[model samples]
Target: MKYQQINKSLFETNRAKFTTKMKPHSLAVFNSNDIYPISADSTMPFEQHRDIFYLSGVDQEESILVLFPDCPKEKHREILFLKETNDHIAVWEGEKLTKEKAFETSGIKTVYWLQDLGKIMFEIMTQCDTVYINTNEHYRANVETETREDRFTKWLKNKYPAHAVAKSNPILQRLRSVKEPIEIDLIQKACDITEKGFRRILEFVKPGVWEYEIEAEFIHEFLRNRSKKFAYTPIVASGNNANVLHYVENNQQCKSGDLILLDVGAEYANYSSDMTRTIPVSGRFSERQKAVYNAVLKVKNEATKMLVPGTDWAQYHVEVGKLMTSELLNLKLLDKADVQNEDKEWPAYKKYFMHGTSHHMGLDTHDYGILTEPMQANMVFTVEPGIYIPDEGFGIRLEDDVVIQKSGEPNNLMKDIPIEVDEIESIMNG
Candidate 1:
């Protein structure tokens, strides 16, 4: 982990919140994500499961957290099972967390080696009437691979068929959506790093620069600032590529007059900060580009204000659609007749700006939140609104992460990053 150790108190509070929602005599388990393989000898980087990291702050692979608040034995109430570390392993794979360090990393005192998991789980399974299994129930989730959590769940269910099964996703969805003060600070750190990267690109971007070169600059800034990697697969789409929506093939050359859509962010200590900023390849937007840019910015600003407490997520988007419709009409892209004759299922504005304006932003890029529920304070969301015009040869998107406030407008986490037309141009030309 390139990031500094998070305070154990955050994990402690998260575990307390989760346990409170569990049924009596129930034990919830969270597993670390597997280091996926790419080929025979190579493997994708290890990323700790966000659920376990949220509750226990255990960032290493092959780790497990179990919470049994009603356990008869006090020490067994909260437990951590970690891969055993020793001097030999330390030389080969760097320092793995020792039992003492595990206690410091997580607040759980009862730590055991991974080999003892079956024996310890068997004992706890007998005592608990219900077992809470962690599952991916995020709204946008379309998982194809069987994760470590899946295998562990299958094993546990097979071993203890009589135990009542319960889902941990619902409880986690609500709990993880709302940020704790410490979690908010970590996310701020990520947004701050992203600001540095965006600033770096502003000066580096120019005609003939490859999109991948811009991607490299962002990663360089992120790594130096302790962000392990991008919050998600970065989109460094230049010109017409931006209209593709999820264009990650950053191989195109940025033309002199084209706009480069940078849908990028940095992840610090497993927390995500999502941001999207489209800028001119030549450091100056044409009159038409400027008009579209300001329109999208207008929609983003208004949409952010609607993220106050008690706002419904679905209704918020509908209102945002209305805001965009007005902008599109002013842009002359949509006429009164177009909107009147448009299908209700897919609004007239969908022709240009299609994606949702915001989503929960936290540990995962598309973080967990029940969209049917009303917005709440401390919940973070990305206010991104874009106008894609392949006919005009460019796309414009401006996004900022914000915290829903108790009153007035939500707080913009990326406020320090330049977003205005003149500011971005000044920095690039200066």
Candidate 2:
């Protein structure tokens, strides 16, 4: 792993929370993600399955975590099946985690190789009455490729047809949504690195700078800070390119008097930090530009305050729509009639601010959380609001990750990253 070691207690607490929700005598299994193939002899980088990573703190491939909390044998209560390491593997590939190291990393006492998984699982299945199968259940999930979890579930169901099946996704959705303190610390580490990258770019960006140049600067900073790659696809959009919400084609010059929309973040130890900020190529916002920019900034500030304990995700967006509506009115982009006749599903604010105001943030940039449920403390979320004005030849967006609090307001994780116009301008010019 490129990043520093995460505490095993985080996984221990996560497993306790998950197993508490399981039916008595039920067992849950989590599989590591496959190293997907690109072509013959080529494969994408390995990423640990979030479910397994959440439960055991094991960030390796060919691993499985079986939690049979009510197992007859206490040693089988929490087991880890890892890929067997050998001298040949050490010479050819690299150091894989040995049993002792796996125990140190995961806090699980009993560890076995993948070859022993079937035998142990058979014994476990015969002892347990139900099995929890992990599945991808994020609301925006559109996975066309069958994942390792899918394959495991298929085989497990076929092999143990008599066992009662339960979905691990539902239990995980609620449990993972509420962050542990250690998980919050890891996410904050990612955000802190992202802040460093953003500040580096603020100094690097100037007139005539190409979009890809900015992207390179961010990656350079992220790598030096122990990040593997971007949290998601980066968008280094300059001028009108900012209007395209998912713009990633970074192949244009940043003209003076225009703004660059940097939608980039870092991935530290599989945790994500999402941020978006528009900056001037000339290190100063024009009168009209500053008005729109400050409006979006105000919206982001107010919208984040809505992310507190017990806030409804749906209701929060509606309130944010009203705030954006007023901002658009002030920006002269919308009138009373536009809002009066606007469809309830798609409000007039959609004309300028087309995307959702925020989403849950943590492991995945759009991390899993039950949107239908009320918000809870320690749940991290991104409060991003933007106004894309193609007609005006520029767009503005401001994003910050925040942690929901029990009182007052949410705590902004990106608070150290400069967002104020004066501060950004000063740093850029200084």
Candidate 3:
């Protein structure tokens, strides 16, 4: 792992929280993500499943975590099964976790190799009444690939059909929504890295530079800062491309007087930080561009304050819509009649600002959080609001990662990043 090792106490606390929610005599299992293949002998990079990482801090493939809090044998509880490693294997494929190293990484006392999993699981399955299966139940999930966890779930159900099946998603949804202090610090580290990348680009961007160049600059900064990769596929959209919310082609040449929308972030210790900043290619926004940019910044600032505890996720967006609507009306994108006759389903504000104003941002860019439930303190969220004007050939968005506080306003993680017109202009020209 390029990033520093996280304290095992965070994973210990996470496991405790999850196991406490389990039914008595129930056992839960989590698997690392498989190294996806592209073609024969070709494969994508290995990325550990966030669920398993959250519980055990195991960042390697072919690893499993079994939480059997009520096992008859005391040592059977909180077990980690890792792939067996030897000196020969270490020399060929890099170092895998040794038993003692695994204990240090995960805070679990008992560790076994993967080969013993079947025998050990069978012995424990009979001792437990219920088996908890982890599933991807995030609202934005559209997974089609058969994950390692999914295959294990299928096998477990077929082999032990008599055992009661339970869902771990609900418990995890609530637990992962609220961040641990350590997790928050990791996310803040990711945000700090993103700040460095953004500031780097502020000076690197210039008219006639290709969009891919800007993307390269960000990756360079992220890699040096120990972020293995971006939190998600970055969007280096320039000019009209910004109007398309998910623009990522990054092939077009940036033109003078055009705005580039950088929807990018750096990940540290598997925690994510999401940020979007739209800046002029020539280091100076025209009068009209500044107006739209300031509007989005104002909305972002106001929406962040509303992320306190007890704020309903759905209602908060509705309120943010009203805020954007007023700004749209002032920007002359909409008039009184446009809003008055606008359908509640698709308001006039949708013409300019189409996407949601905020989303829970942490482990994943769109992290695991039940949006229907009320917000809570220590929950991290991204406050991003944008106004896209295709006809005007420019769009503006300003975003910041913030932690919802128990009292007062949320704390901005990217507060050090330049956002104001004067600040950005000064840095870009400096």
Candidate 4:
């Protein structure tokens, strides 16, 4: 891991909170993500399963964690199963966590090799009446691939047909939504790294530069600063390419008069920071570009203020629609009749500002949070508002990751990244 070691207290506290919600005499299991294969002799990078990493701070593959708070034997209450390391693995794969190192990384004192899982699980399943299975239930989840956790769930269910099964996703969704102070600090560090990348690009961007060049600059900055990689696939959309919401080809050249939308961020210690900023390829925005940019900036600022505690997620978007409507009318993108006859379901603002203004941002780019629930303090969200004018040959978007506060306005994590029209222009031309 390129990032520094996380304090095990966060994981200990997370496990305590999760165990309290489990049914009595129930045991919960979490598995690390698999190293997926692309083809023969090649595989994708290994990413630790967020749930297991959240609870145990174990950041390796082929690991499992078990929690049985009501177990009759104290030693079996919390256990970690890790792949045993040998001389061959030590020489080829560098290093694997030793039993002592596992204890230091995770609060659990009991550690066993992966080969002992069957016998130990058999003993524990006899003592527990219920089993909690970790499943992916994030609102945006569209997983088609079977995971290690899924396989374990199937094996456990087939082996113990009489045990009651429960879902761990619901409890995790709520708990992961609210940030612990340490989590906020890690996220801030990611945002700070993203700011450095953005500033570097500001000086590097110029007319005739390929979009991929700018993408290269960000990754270069991120790796040197200890970030493993981007939180998500980056978007370096130039010109009308910004109109495509998920544009990531990054193959086009930035023309002199075109607006390039950079939807990019850096990740540190598995925490994510999301940001989007549109800048002129020629180092200054034209009058028309400046108008749309300011409109998007205005909407982003007002939408951020609405992210206070107790705000409803769905209704918050509705209110943001109203703010965008007023800006659209002012921008002459919409007229009086367009506003009056707007559909309640779609709204007139959809013509200019189409996507949702905010989403939960953390370990995952689109982090875990129940939209049906009211907002709470320490929950982080991204306030991104944009006006995509494809017909005009350019699009503008400005986004910043923010933390909902108990009082006053939400805290902007990208506070130091240049956003103002003058500030961006000066930095680009300076």
Q: TM-score for each prediction?
A: 0.99, 0.99, 0.99, 0.99
lDDT of 1 at 244: 94
lDDT (10s digit) by residue, model 1, range 321-415: 99999999999999999999999999999999989999998999999999999999999999999999999888999999999999989899999
Model 4 spans with C-alpha error above 4 angstroms = none
Query: What are the lDDT figures for the candidates, one per model?
Result: 0.95, 0.92, 0.94, 0.94
* TM-score attained by model 2: 0.99
lDDT of 3 at 56: 90
Residue pairs with clashing backbones, model 2 = none
Model 1 scores worst on lDDT over the 10 consecutive residues at 94-103
Model 2 lDDT, residue 287, Cα: 96
TM-score of model 3 vs. true structure: 0.99
Q: Model 2 shows how many backbone clashes? A: 0
Question: Which parts of model 1 have CA positions greater than 4 angstroms off?
Answer: none
Cα lDDT tens digits for candidate 4, 1-430 = 9999999999999999999999999999999999999999899998999999999999999999999999999999999999998889989997899899899988889999999999999999999999999999988899999999999999999999999999999999999999999999999999999999999999999999999999999999999999999999999999989999999999999999999999999999999999999999999999989988998899899999899999999999988898988988898999999989989888889988889999998889999999999999999999999999989988888999999999989989899999999999999999
lDDT by residue for model 3 (133-203), tens = 99999988899999999999999999999999999999999999899999999999999999999999999
Residue 123's lDDT in candidate 1: 93
Task: Order candidates by lDDT, high to low.
Answer: 1, 4, 3, 2
For lDDT, candidate 2 versus 3, the one ahead is 3
